[model samples]
Target: MISVKNVTLRRGVKVVLDQASVTFAPGEKVGLVGRNGAGKSSFFALLNGSIHEDSGEFSIPPQWRMAQVAQDMPETTQSATEFVVEGDTVLQAARAEVAAAEASDDGMAMAHAYTALYDAGEHDAPARAQALILGLGFSVAELDQPVNSFSGGWRMRLQLARALMCPSDLLLLDEPTNHLDLDALVWLEAWLKRYAGTMIVISHDREFLDAVTQVTVHVDNARLVRYGGNYSKFEDMRAEQMALQTAALAKQADKIAHLQKFIDRFKAKASKARQAQSRVKALERMEKIAPVLADAEFSFEFKEPQNVPNPMLSMLGASFGYPAPEDAVAGTPPTVIVKGINRSVLAGQRIGILGANGQGKSTLVKTVAHALTPIAGEISEGKGLNIGYFAQQELDVLDPEASPLLHMQRLAHDLPAHLRAGQGTGEQTLRTYLGTFNFGGDMVKQAVGTMSGGEKARLVLAMIVWQRPNLLLLDEPTNHLDLATREALGVALNEFEGTVMLVSHDRALLRSVCDEFWLVSKGGVEPFEGDLDDYQQFLLDEARSQREAAAASQRKR
Candidate 1:
């Protein structure tokens, strides 16, 4: 069990936790939730011993082993499997003991070290590491690839795999699903369910927390509020509590007013002055109940498109993917991720693209966004079709050195002449528009590079909405957004009048915004008949089959 009593924590001068108390039983799966700056990460740091409490007591079992994914991106030439295997600290220690014993030529020590290595399951480390890698959306062929070869997102997945490979009694995961696709997230949820340890996670993905957490801990007003159920349950209970608090506050306000009235009327007269003084004391002694402040909700709207093109775009036997490497032979053919795609996106259509990572979900979205060309066939687009694309790599579209005003100024001139018309790119006009997205005052002048990831994502959305395109193609747009912002995005997307094609791992967003889903899998694209629940089961079954095949192949050798 972990116990925190009247703990005071601070970062610089900010008191993130003041006299906060909470308790956690062993083996509980906890979900930590709060607003963006509510210190959820700081609390995690406390558990991991990165910092100490400024006052009061915090105690955890000293014998408990801990595991956490490293935040730093790993740069190494080590094979992916080797890097993950090294996360098994006990196994590594045992191997080191064996090597030392051999060097000393000690027969008894060597025998003991060999036994320890065997007991540590040294022989199974590679298999365990590979299992983790595969479950995190890596292909079997990529298992032996160098860690440096993978992209930043893929490297983060590798980091997660390494953390899972460690043996621990307490596991801490911060936004583990940020880099995962829906299929990979499903696998991770299943894996976490099977873990026999205490797990605490911080994530913006609602379905993930609901599925994995049995308890919810909220950080609010520099205090930790513990709840008895998952995130959805906490929300319901919190709402009820707020309603009751509001009524109580109203009742208290009436009493305070009545006391003040009595004191004011009698204090002037000598006969009742004594009673008035007593009433004043009473009023001063009364503990005031604070009014409930509603959580800030971030919201922005997509402007109405200048024109809605019927049959916005049609993909007739189109092949979506990338061309061969620049170093490849000139005659080499382009790589086709999804072929024979026959689909038409109509005006006001809502499409949710579904697929495992690297299975052409992004490839299809990129093609539609005009970032990639089809390897074959044709994509017939409507004459007036305009696209507002939110790429997976949003930073690519933003200039780090530029401010929000500069970004909008450039966009104003870059848009088609028809859309621009006679509109001026005045700084005040642009600032007023950016204000709708909550970028106001001095924030509009802050360098894009210095802003938080969520702020950057909001800026991207602002730029996209300004285009007023008929078709919105968003790929993983909620990666950096908090829960409130994500909810706001869902509401805004629903209110949007034009077509939407979203590719995201957030189940809540997909369920709310998408009217239909297009599954991009098996080198082809087709309509999915069922809902997200069905897709999750399908992904689980496929992963099981793959694991079995891999195991059987190894056994046969």
Candidate 2:
């Protein structure tokens, strides 16, 4: 349904896409993969016509409409329903024309309006809208909520719902699963599976890509390479391709060396000179294979302090919930969100918190970090426990006006003066710390506002690591990270000797880095001894049990 041919996109002097060609067929789900800053978002923007390429041939079939789910939500004060309804401009106009005709009592206008309404299938619009809303995880009551009232994640969902509601032949989604919970992600995957149009999604979630996409389009070194399978298949194919290329290159190198040796040895020999020259010419004409090195991997080595005692953070009979207004005391006992939470983070414990969205995972992390006081029960810290907390809303703690260096300097200033004695001056220490986080040279001087989301996250993490805390509390730490960075952080965390309490939806990272699972659900915390897959199976079993219990209850009723 859409084709890009010889597309060359440039940002200033940097070439993002060079003679890249790709095609999407109807009902095709294409997964776009690349490392961070490798022009995945730029490619989407070019396809969406939000930005024009320097030189390219992009084709969309005539009468084929397109919609893009943007990473940033558009600034708007409109109600969610209004925004979604407005997405279908023709339908909205037809409805308005129908209303006007009915008000004026014009017979000809009424006939025209009725025809328009019928042609547009106005009766089906409401049902379609409701389906889109629910599919994107919005409740019925939230349909009328102002778009501005929702957080960035929810607002992105609203934008996606609006795009999905539109009658588009092609959909362009960039990082659509970044903010989605597992349930919503499943819904989106199902929707795309049954969708009648084409879709191209740029996402870092391997599982989502595998579940939704049939083709993988890789953007590497300013070129587009298509792999005819899901992500896992693509990985296998890519590895084989690299190995073949390496072997071919090795053979070519051996041939070239042998030919050169022949030329050197037979330069004065009349009989062998012609054959040697032919070999030289063949070598010159041969297309040399470029080395297919794997993408650069990020390695995070956290410099944590040594030898901390057990039970870095512990809680007993903990209960936590946001306080309702005193005048609005109509609920029963304020509806405790989490209770009977008995958990401990020993010196070597690597615990992962898992649950659905808005299930008090963040609240539990805050309580463990001592950022939130539990309404009931006690929390205790071991002796000499140093804590490093990485909150989900990292931007809230960053100063927009400060440079990266300045931010680190301020953080360093808060450290004990005795520790700073051998660490050089404050500016030097900050620069050194920034370098450790891969923000060297000009990057350290850039303002925090100008930094990318990944950069800011890394900077915050670097600051935390500099303190060398004995215990760490991380909430959705991989939210803005690319695959390489996520793997790097996971490796670092897995190797760290300190206690860790993490809340994340990245199952791969959790499985690799965590030793146990602390699942928050239905107003309580349950400790499970296993990896993410085990916890996931536990959830599935629990869900099945709940369904059986409900059926039994219904039969009893």
Candidate 3:
């Protein structure tokens, strides 16, 4: 068990936690939730002993082992499997002991070292590491790749796998689903559900919290408030508590009014003066209950398109991939991941593109958005077609050094002459446009590089909508956004008058905004027959098949 007693914490002059207390029993699954700057990360740091509280005490069992995902991306030449296997400190130490025993030619030491190896499960460590890596979304072939060969996002997934590989009594995960696709998210949910240790996770994904957490811990008003159930249940309970508090305040106010009325009438008469003085004292001693402040609510919408063109874009026998090396001569083949992609995106079509990571989902989106050229075949466009694209890597569309207002200025300046008409050149016009995305006054002048990921995402949305494009290609647009902002984006997309093709792991957004689904798998694109739930089951079956195949190959060897 772990206990926090009257803890006070501070960062600089800001008081993050004031007299907060909470307790966690063994094997309890708790969901930590709050606004972005509510000191959730600081609380995690305190539990890990990297931070000391300003006052009070926090205690955890000294004998219990802990595991948490590292935030730093590792730069190493080690193979992915070896890196993850090294997470089990006991297994690694035992293997080293066996090596040393053999080198020293000590039979007694060798016997003890071999025994330790067996106890540590050294023989099955590789298989265990492989299982974790595969479950977190790595291909069998990529298992042998060097750690440095993977991208930043994939490297984070490796870090998560390494953390899960550790033998621990307590597990801490902070935003573990940020980098995962829907398939891997589902797999992780299942894995965490079966974990035998105490787990505390911080996440903004409500559906994931509802599926995995048994309790909810809310960080609000510089204090920790514990609730009895998951996120939805907590919301319901919180609503009831606030309603009851409001009623109590109202009743108190009515009693005070009656007492004051009596005191005013009787204070003038000498006979009832004693009773009036008693009422005065009672009113003076009464404690006033403060009204509850409501949580901030955010909402916004996209401007209607300037034109709606039928069949906005179409592809015939198209191949999507990267171009050959610069040194290669003419006719050097391009590396194609998806081929024979014949599809037409009509006006107002809402399509959700689904696929595992590295299976060419982003490539297809880039191709349709004209960010990349199709290596073969034709991609025809309609008359007056306007494309608004949101890249998964926000840096692709944002200039880090520029301010939000400047980005809008560039967009206004770059528009075609006829389209630019009536759009004002004044700074007020730019500020007004950005304000809808929550960038007010001083925020409009802040540098994009210094802003948070959610702010950068909002800036990107503001830029995209300013042009009034007839088609939108959004890839993982909700990655940096919080739940409220994500809901706002979904509302805007649902009300949008243009065609949309979105690639996101946010199942809520996908289910709410998308009406049709396209599956990109095994180097081909096809239509899917069902909803998000059906797609989740398909992924489970696929993972099971791969596991069986790997086992068969291992037996053959």
TM-scores vs. true structure, each candidate: 0.89, 0.79, 0.87
How well does candidate 2 score on lDDT at residue 202? 85
Instruction: List model 1 lDDT by residue over 199-247, tens digit each.
Output: 9999999889999999999999999999999887787677567557666
For model 2, give the 10-residue run with minimal summed lDDT: 285-294
Ranking by lDDT: 1, 3, 2
lDDT of 1: 0.85
Which pairs clash in model 1? none
- Better model by TM-score, 1 or 3? 1
Local accuracy of candidate 3 as per-residue lDDT tens digits, 466-529: 7788899999998898866875676577667899999998876776567678999999999887
In order, candidate lDDTs are 0.85, 0.72, 0.82
Off by over 4 Å in 1: 245-294, 421-424
- Give the candidate number with the greatest TM-score: 1
What order do you get sorting by TM-score, best first? 1, 3, 2
Best by lDDT: 1
